[model samples]
Target: MTHIDDEPGTVSEPPRGGRGRRTALIAVAVVVVAAVAVVGALGLGGGGDEGPGAPPRAGSLVPVTRATLTERTEVDGQLGYGAEIPLPVKATGTVTWLPEAGTRAKRGDTLLRVDDRPVVLLYGSLPMYRDLGLTARAPGGAGDAPSGGGTGTGDGGTAAGGGTGAGAAGAAEGAAAPGARTADGGTGKAAAANPSASPAPTGAGTTAATALKGMDVLQFETNLAALGYTGFTVDEEFTARTADAVKRWQKSLGVPETGTVGIGDVIYSAGKVRIGRPGVRLGQAVGENALTYTGTARKVVVNASAAGASWAVRGTAVRVRLPDGTSVKGEVASVGRQATAPEGGSGEDGAGEGAATLPVTVTIRDQKSVGRLESGPVTVEYVGREVKDVLTVPVAALVALAEGGHGLETADGGFVAVKTGLFADGRVEVSGSAVRAGLKVRIPE
Candidate 1:
């Protein structure tokens, strides 16, 4: 994936090593971009080269507009629970039972039956790989997510709130922070992000009364609080009050009050999740890749270019189209951190290498408008780049300069040199001492 350089306003020259006529290639690419911009601004029927017409008749001349020029675009999207959540198995056992598809499982609920033992679900974005038993190592890690493993929601709903579990000392693990808002409308900053940042596993299976130190103890402490067992400072140090709280939580679950959390006792996740189809059948041998499922949340997801990502900030309004031809308002809820390489086909027919893309998620504002359609293809329109109060002209109006760059040919016999900035809809952002909103320019037929 290519990183956008933070370099300020540095001009980038085109690739110099290619064998083709670079100037012609660049000119062709520029024409295409200008055509798109003009088509968007003028609301033309479609885009293609319109052959040049005779010298500008009064009717053929178009005046530049002084209002805002916004690039509103409609892109295809998938309407479903944003992305699929994988339930990485930390336990090894034969599958005894699997939940029916479309079942909804909350935290602490039974997600599956392995060897007749229930695989309980825990809410948090982090995955579980080790048992939650008493140990000397802490549990926080520098990772992110709360896709609610072992579950899938088709409605495209997200795990609500901004939250994070802090790892005890350097012993934190299962850190999943997608930087989402917490339920209290607060950011989930108590997060344990460094998965490998935890203390080394040592002194396993200490007595319940032992004053333990590590992230596992810390997570065990936090899970107890989330489960409503309070009265202790949630930390890596296992004090007497912490033990009392754990024992009470165990008792509530109808298990022995051991005052110790087993690896299988509790689960972690970003929050509650809707489960999808199970990955295994009954009696299947459990391997490294055991549990997997889709999600049930209803969100419109788009794979947008870096240009589109520029407008992916939270709270941007979007128009979504369902399968029924119904249109509903949506909002940009989240944007991914890093850009990812285009997946698959890199050949002539595929998303070529070198260029990267950003993933954007939009949530439907009027939920009732969507009705029962949970998963399917949809379209969304985003309000893109806006150039305000500037002189603009149809891309077809541009006349290549013999001296280099581009210029605007006046209706009569003169040409004006202009500096261009943004390109949107079919209009190019142009400014010059002489250019105004009402100036006339020639257009190709």
Candidate 2:
């Protein structure tokens, strides 16, 4: 093994390796044996005539070194799709078909078949909440708008009877009430009689042509447009052109070409999904939860102890030690807020019961870094502490002084009191007035 010597009064070991920790321990044992032999010779008068200020010889000696010290902690983690989310069904029908477990589906792909119609997948954050169709602008007419909301036709054109009907109604109201205004811009006698009354909006006869509008509409139109259909603007309003595009999409899926899309016609997710086992059987009525899915990418998850979870912050860089003795770089993707107790038995900390843990998600930076491994237990390593440009020695070098402090013994049998800083990887930082580079320190046998 290589030795580091920067401080005169200490000996330090290098950082421990993933697989070489056992080997490092064995080497320490060998060094102890050799030191004992050297001390035995010194005790047998190998060094004669000790000076007044010099102490008796100890074990073998090693020089101290100034180097960067880092402490690392390793935790157990499992590699797989981060988490599975249940896919709820909103359509009312019999479940005719379901994809096999582990099947992958992307945008516009069929996720499940209900009543012999496909429930397609789409990439979006909004859920479908209403049927995307036209609404008539006529007052109390056959319209799709709900109560207390904007109403219009999907064709972006004026409503029928908007001219003559509105003029007749205005004329009748102006005659009945002296202050009301007619269809024309001039105010009627009713307005002079009641100056405080607010005039009815002039454009009430002609409503702005619009359709069902919401972020969901925009998401649907975007996905529909992306699937090669055209003529509809991708926006929050689903207009006549959007309904026509939906019909074309429905035709391709062999579904009814009704110019409306029901809430159950599509499912939205973040991106491509890998299907889990179906929760309901074929021919059964669709229930609240029909199946499950997860993102296509693999990730590492750790059930870290809540008490020691400071390192589990999101975006923190980490190293994953694979079973094959190799390592890959990753970062914390998420950290769960809720804590849960272990199911049974001891946990990683050897706590027998009632140990709570929070879930942590780690994302590998490179997709192919883990090689062919799909899902398995792995080790995640995090740096616990670090100190740079400090004089360090093996933890075995320091000795307790009778004066209520710590000191290191030099090769000349002189003792130098020192202050300790950080202890990491079997080495420690030490400093004192007399301690300097190349000062040899004794290891206790």
Tell me the number of clashing residue pairs for each predicted model: 68, 13
| Candidate number achieving the greatest TM-score relative to the actual structure | 2
In angstroms, the error of model 2 at 173 is 17
Give the 10-residue window scoring lowest on summed lDDT in candidate 2: 148-157
For residue 392, model 1's alpha carbon misses the true position, in angstroms, by 11
Model 2 agreement with the true structure over 1-445: per-residue lDDT tens digits: 3334334543333456533643454354445534433432343221222323333234778888897776677889999986678875688899999999889999999999999989999998877777777765765334322221221122221122232333434433334433334464334433322336554433233444458888888888889889999897899898989989988998999988987888888889989999987889999999777889998888999989888999898899998989898989999999999877788845555477746799999999797888878789999988777789999876667665544466676664445678988766556688887777777777766
lDDT tens digits, residues 178-238, model 1? Answer: 3445464433222222243442332222222236677766766676687788999988887
**Best candidate per lDDT, number?**
2
Number of colliding residue pairs in model 2: 13
Candidate 2 positional error at 4, Å: 20
lDDT of 2 at 427: 63
Candidate 2's C-alpha lDDT?
0.71
